[model samples]
Target chain A: MNTTLQQFNVEKIRTDFPILQQEVHGKPLVYLDNAATSQTPTVVIEALQKYYREYNSNVHRGVHRLSHIATDAYEGAREKVRRFLNASSLQEIIFTKGTTDGINLLASSIGRGLIKPGDEIVISAMEHHSNIVPWQLMCEDRGARLRVIPINDDGEIIFEAYEDLLNERTKLVSIVHTSNSLGTVNPLRQIIDLAHNKNVPVLVDGAQAVPHTAVDLRALDCDFFVFSSHKVFGPTGVGVLYGKKEWLEKLPPYQGGGDMILNVTFAGTKFNELPYKFEAGTPNIADVIGLGVALDYVQQIGYDAISSWENELIQYALKRLQEIEGLRFIGNAKHRAGAISFVLENIHPHDIGTILDREGVAVRTGHHCTQPVMQCFKVPATTRASFAFYNTKEEIDLLIKALYKVIEMFS
Target chain B: MDELRDLYQEVILDHNKNPKNYFQMDEATHSAEGHNPLCGDQVEVFLKVDNERIIDISFQGHGCAISKAASSVMTTMLKGKTITEAKKLFEKYQHLITAEMSEAVDLHEYGHLAVFAGVREFPMRVKCASLSWHTMLQALEEKKEIATTE
Candidate 1:
């Protein structure tokens, strides 16, 4: 690692996000809903504008000059993603609509082809509905059993139980690297290792993890990883799915359409190679290119600095939030990333969210697409304040103050 | 805090804390469960009708003040009224909040429900306020209303 030249500046970084400058309900917007979707940087917005403004042509097939430029930019984005996750090859990365689409693509394709009766698909209790439903549908289709590894009170996955769940019958072990609800960062290395021992493939839901921390596919050694671009400062409707070459090649295509086929006749058709086979349609070229720019922006900032800044923000928020009376903080996992779930006694989560929003503080207040997780916690819903690198302690203080107001109103 | 207090008036809070007709009715003709997946507000509405008249009504649940108050008031107002009258009252009450059938509602008799009129300002809470009423309608097997899990 090279010694840092210029230290990361939080104030300078905040200026890059145009939406953050605006006021909502008479107060400055303190966006804490980054886990849902991050606000795009000016560079990313400009990239999208530049694409439509300059090279607005269909990619891959056209022999025209603009087509070549468009194709290059689109494929260039793929290379950026290839480096972003530290995947061994560009062929491993496939673009989908978002994280849900990516997981569904894997589950529908591989789960349809390989999984059989009596086989088991192991998933953790912390999985989003996107991760859980696809496996459930696949298992239902294949006569395979769906097994869940439960989480502890601390919201971390019980690694011992996860190991116990892994056996010869386990076909796939899909788990979220970082939980969206609890901010629990699961032990993926041990999870991958245990699954690999049983000749099972592991698909990591990296939607929450990719935005907050460094994700090295080579180091984690997971067979598959998926994350959405929107959650990481890029446009919505674009996500990256990285799979080992062998696994992707063996699995069938997800959706059959224009771009994925090499040659088609009345009688038969031949599919295109690796990622193109999976992509299968006119992709979100502009957004993917913009995602490349977002990745570039993050690379410029550097993850180590981002992590340190966010860790400080989280610690500060947690300490201050602890002081409010009747404010019960949920998900007290030792290892966390940019999420805080809690409840103000006698106040509905929706009310808390409403008041917070009125104070120009945006937070998620619901089951967060994880109804089962809410069941485990024995709460109907919780107000979740998720942070990002651009977020400041000032914003966290604003949240604390607003939450205090909510407590007073409800109690 | 005052805005929230305005939303959760003394009447709403009084009902929320010690709700009127808050119990399971014995020998009830119909009972239905209202579950809001979003906030986890689960309400069970029990109705006892005699010759199309709601002789007694009650509700039991765990929820926010708005939901609790809505159910409590709904049960309180429905008693001693015919099923048709109760249906009309629900319509007038809903119209008062949603501004859908505002013209039909007198807005005087339904004054307690007026506190909930602000509920329409918050779209998400609209479902929370209506969950119990929709559940009650479902228990009565009224075909016009639809029960939803918010």
Candidate 2:
């Protein structure tokens, strides 16, 4: 742990995000829904504006000056992503619509090629629907089986049970790196090692992890990783699918269109190399550029600083919220990140969310696309308050204050 | 802020706390489940219709204050009303909540159900307040499919 990085100046950091300055319902906005999507910084917003205002042109096609600039910027964003994830090569990073699109691409392409009838795909119980549904569709298509690795009461995956699920028949393992609703920081290093031991590939959904922690693909050695840009303070409609080069080469092309083809013919067409083969059609150019800048922004602030600040905030929040009568935390994983989910006694999360909104605090109220986890916890839904570096202890105080009001209103 | 007050009025809150006719009707002639997937609000409405009249109505499920209260109020207003009369009331209640009517409608016409007229102010929660009523419609029509506030 870097002590210097731990000294995060949150007040100053909040200045970069212009939207954080606004008020809601006559009170200053207290945005606690970072898990859904983070607030965009001015630099990222400016990057988007600059792309459209200046040399806006279709990438990879023209020899003209504007096209050259656009193509360079677009490709440059890929390089930025490669460095951000510490991937060995640019071919490993594929731009996607978001985490869902990335997972779908991997499932449709790699899954279609590898999965056979009776073959099993192992996923943890805490996976979001985005990760689960695509695999389910792939399994349905190929007559494959979907096996779930159950979690402990604290929402952390039982490592021994996960190991028990892995065998020669297990074709692939997909897991969430950090749970969006529960905030569990899974043991990905150990998980990857276990899967690798069984000669099985793993695809880690890092949508909720990327914003709070530093992810080094080389260190984790996951076969594939996916995350959304919007969740990391970038523009929406763009994400990354980081795949090891060997696996990407083996997978079939996700979609067929221009730029994805090397040679087109009346009878048969040849596909392009690694990343481009998966990224079919014209992509979200401006948002990709914005994502690159957002990565740079996070890098400058440093993940250590962000993680340290957020850890303190969560601890403080948990303590304060525990003081409230009958409030129960849904996930109490020893290792957690980004979000905190809880249910107030005899009060629905929706009611609490509505009251919190009136107090100008935004929180996500529901199963959070992890209905399986909700079922595991035996709750209809949980109220989640996810944090970013820009969020403060003051905001947590406001949330606690508003929660008291919810109790009063319901009582 | 007044909109918030109207949305969570005392009447609505009371209904949510101690909902009336909130039991599964085992001998119901018609029944349907309503689900608001976005919020995980689920409601099951049961109706016992006799000679074009609603002899008994009850609901069972879990949801927010707005949804639970709406279901409670709906069961109270639906009992003893003719099928045609229930349909008309449903239409009028829908009109009041959606605020689609050009002319202002009298709250007295809706009686206790008028408490939900304040829901018109909250566009997002309109679904919450209407989930049970929509399920009630499905139950009355004897639709075998589940109703959703999508």
Candidate 3:
């Protein structure tokens, strides 16, 4: 490892993860399942344990000191998220259950109000089900067309084809910033610009992107960005949706409940302002604070360094898996993140995954919840081994060694 | 070899590589397809039955070693058996793999399938191993309902 990347310290970083020090089937665990959800750091877990131990109270309505402290921590997380994504204001950041709930909130609120009959909502074929299902449901409800941007053989969105799909009827263009299955980092800056020229808003699903790369919402100029905290090495049940203040104010409230309301007389009630208006009922308070710690953890290590290190891991993994005969990688995108997907001839992905698991190397097998991308690649599924910054080249070598055993067994 | 001995025995791998009764019967009376989307296991079971007796049975699909081997072993045992007898075999095989009736299963008849009897220990793979059996049941139902309808 380079001295710059070693500032994060792989051994020290692994120490923070208690699960990493353990064994699976009498062998040391080699976890490569970051694309699903990353292993949480000690600071994130301690933050959650500390919150429940003390200052455990519902936020936003208390006058006591504990309640006040809890409220500050909860809202402080929103501010951290706002800064992390480089959003214009704190009001633009709304807490959600996860990326799925965030996209659904946008689809129901903004999508219902803006998308009309004969309008078009564009999405890429490489999107997760969370990104695809919401827009699909919205389009089916409204008499709108769900246009898909075709992906190239490498699984990146075809930019020219996406630009051609944008027209006067295009109301929204939602896409994944990085494909979960393929690890293709899409050209969001250009995609957002083209949609803006057509006067259409765009939503970038940053669930996979946020973990490996840094995002600046202002520079990207997209209307909305959504990501889950768990994928970013934080606790689950906490996520953030960053939207422009102007766009958020124009849209309807997401869910109607106690916190979202100002006055309820059963006839007509006034709604709360921007961020709170979107957040209904009680939110995942402890996890939200843990998300702040997770962001602070990444900031301390530096995302720029983390990105380069993960890219190196991806490259090393690709090269190692390539050396195994009859083992072909599925997604070979040039501008990819930290996912390595492949298939072995005469060996099913599940079998490969199982055999690898016995050797203490874990990898995800099958469609990876992106069925359309699987269809685009014309393979039923691929075994994916995704990496985090803490991952080492030695781990990739172990993966290759185990994969060779799998290939030989089938041969 | 000892490391892979417990999971992929020689008999199991042999059956997987050169699967017995593995072909497509074009003039099959019963055919059904089954898929496990979670693992991307797909199996199409084709059976040729004549007067309530299975004259031939084969499978054509892609899957894990356990699934491929399990289906091949089931086909070898079920060929030339009556539909009712095959249904009984299906039940016995299900019980054998699920560890419901382990001691009762005869190893001589089951052959390589005896290796799959250990599969019940691995719960997650039980679905992959049971996929072809599910397709067989589906084919049996299709034969019953469609045959009556015709």
TM-score of each: 0.95, 0.98, 0.94
Q: Stretches of candidate 1 above 4 Å error?
A: A1-6, B1-3, B100-109, B142-146
The alpha-carbon lDDT assigned to residue A158 of candidate 1 equals: 86
- Kindly list the per-residue Cα lDDT of model 3 for residues A1-411, writing each as its tens digit: 467555656777778888898888777889998999899999999999999999999999989988899999999998899989999899999999999999999999966678789999899988998989998899999889999999888777888898789989998999998888998888888898889988889899999988888898889999999999999999999999988999999999989997998888868999998789999898899999999999999888788879877877887787777777777777778889968788887777887888888889999998899988888887878999999987887888888888878877776
Per-residue accuracy of model 1 over A146-182 as CA lDDT, tens digit each: 9999988878888888888888888899999889999
- Model 3: per-residue Cα lDDT at residue B27: 90
Question: What are the candidates' individual DockQ scores?
Answer: 0.52, 0.79, 0.56
Report iRMS values in order.
2.4, 1.1, 1.9
Model 1 clash tally? 0
Which is the leading candidate under TM-score? 2
Model 2: per-residue Cα lDDT over A1-411, one tens digit each: 455334887888899999999999888999999999999999999999999999999999999999999999999999999999999999999999999999999899866688789999999999999999999999999999999999989999988899889988999999999999999999988999999998999999999999999989999999999999999999999999999999999988988998898999999999998789888898899999999999999999998778788898999899999999898999999999999999988888998988899899999999999999999999999999999989988999999999998888888
The 10 consecutive residues of candidate 2 chain A with the worst lDDT sum are A1-10
Q: Fill in the DockQ of model 3.
A: 0.56
* lDDT, each prediction: 0.87, 0.92, 0.85
